[model samples]
Target: MDINDLRSAVTLVSLLLFAGIAAWAWRPRNQAAFEDAARLPFSDEQGGQS
Candidate 1:
């Protein structure tokens, strides 16, 4: 396809990818995991032996 067609396809794919990630991140099932990750910086390294 032409350059314009390729550009449009890439943009649409990127938008869909971003929307999917956003949905996944906001889903209720993942809330606890995301919250734990958000606390990584504040957690003590000794107790945080992953």
Candidate 2:
């Protein structure tokens, strides 16, 4: 009802939304690019050897 309450509610909603998005993004079907990126440093290291 007050400004402080409104601010708290908005903050809680945004936090929940961000958590949901993070969970969706971490699902297995969406992880291949993330895995590839995780491996990129190693790939670059190998490329530098040759």
Candidate 3:
């Protein structure tokens, strides 16, 4: 296996991984979970007593 072949394989694997993740993340069934994750930083877990 030449260096170029390894490079091409790595690129193809990376692209496939990116596409799979994008699909998983954007699918309708995952919308709620993603939305909840998106709100984690603003959740105010300390309560409203401030």
Candidate 4:
């Protein structure tokens, strides 16, 4: 394939990968996990524990 064809293939693959990740992140079952992650920065842990 030519350079143009290779570029198109890469773009299509990147788009598909992004869509798959978006779908996974938006699924209802993952809502709780995502929320917990969103709260991590505000948690009150003082320091890293052993």
Candidate 5:
């Protein structure tokens, strides 16, 4: 019921919401796009020479 308690509750809620969204976003069909995007930076960093 204090400011500290309110802050902790907000942080916990935010983390849970983020986890839910992340799980939904990474569902099988969406996962391939996410994986491709995730690898893009690494590929670019390696000069994309492969």
Candidate 6:
């Protein structure tokens, strides 16, 4: 119930949150969506018209 304990709890929560998001992003069901997002910057280009 001290400041250090609170800090440790916050750190643990943050780590768990990050891991969950990483797992979600790498799941097979999301591959296509992620790939499409990864290509978004180049999506506007067509037939080398730039």
Cα TM-score per model: 0.81, 0.59, 0.80, 0.84, 0.57, 0.82
Q: Please report, in order, the local distance difference test score of every candidate based on alpha carbons.
A: 0.94, 0.89, 0.94, 0.95, 0.88, 0.93
Arranged by TM-score, best first: 4, 6, 1, 3, 2, 5
Worst 10 residues of 3 by lDDT: 41-50
Candidate 1 lDDT score at position 9: 99
Give the per-residue lDDT digits (tens) of candidate 3, residues 1-50. Answer: 99999999999999999999999988999999989999998898887665
Pairs that collide in candidate 2 are: none
Over 4 Å off, model 4: 45-50
Tell me how many clashing residue pairs each candidate has: 0, 0, 0, 0, 0, 0
lDDT by residue (tens digit), candidate 1, 8-50 = 9999999999999999988999999999999988887786656
Query: What's the residue-level lDDT of 45 in candidate 5?
Result: 69
The predicted structure with the larger lDDT, 1 or 5, is 1
| Deviation (Å) of 32 in candidate 5 | 8.4
What is the per-residue lDDT of model 6 for residues 1-50, given as tens digits with 9 covering 90 to 100? 99999999999999999999999998999999989999999877765753
Error of 4 at 23 (Å): 0.3
Candidate 1 ranges beyond 4 A from true positions: 45-50
Task: State the lDDT of candidate 2 residue by residue for 1-50, as single tens digits.
Answer: 99999999999999999999999988998799788988877875555644
Q: Tell me the TM-score of model 3.
A: 0.80
User: How much does candidate 2 score in TM-score?
Assistant: 0.59
Better of 3 and 5 by TM-score: 3
The most accurate candidate by lDDT is 4
lDDT of 5 by residue, 1-50 (tens): 99999999999999999999989997898978888998876775656556
Query: Model 5 clash pairs?
Result: none
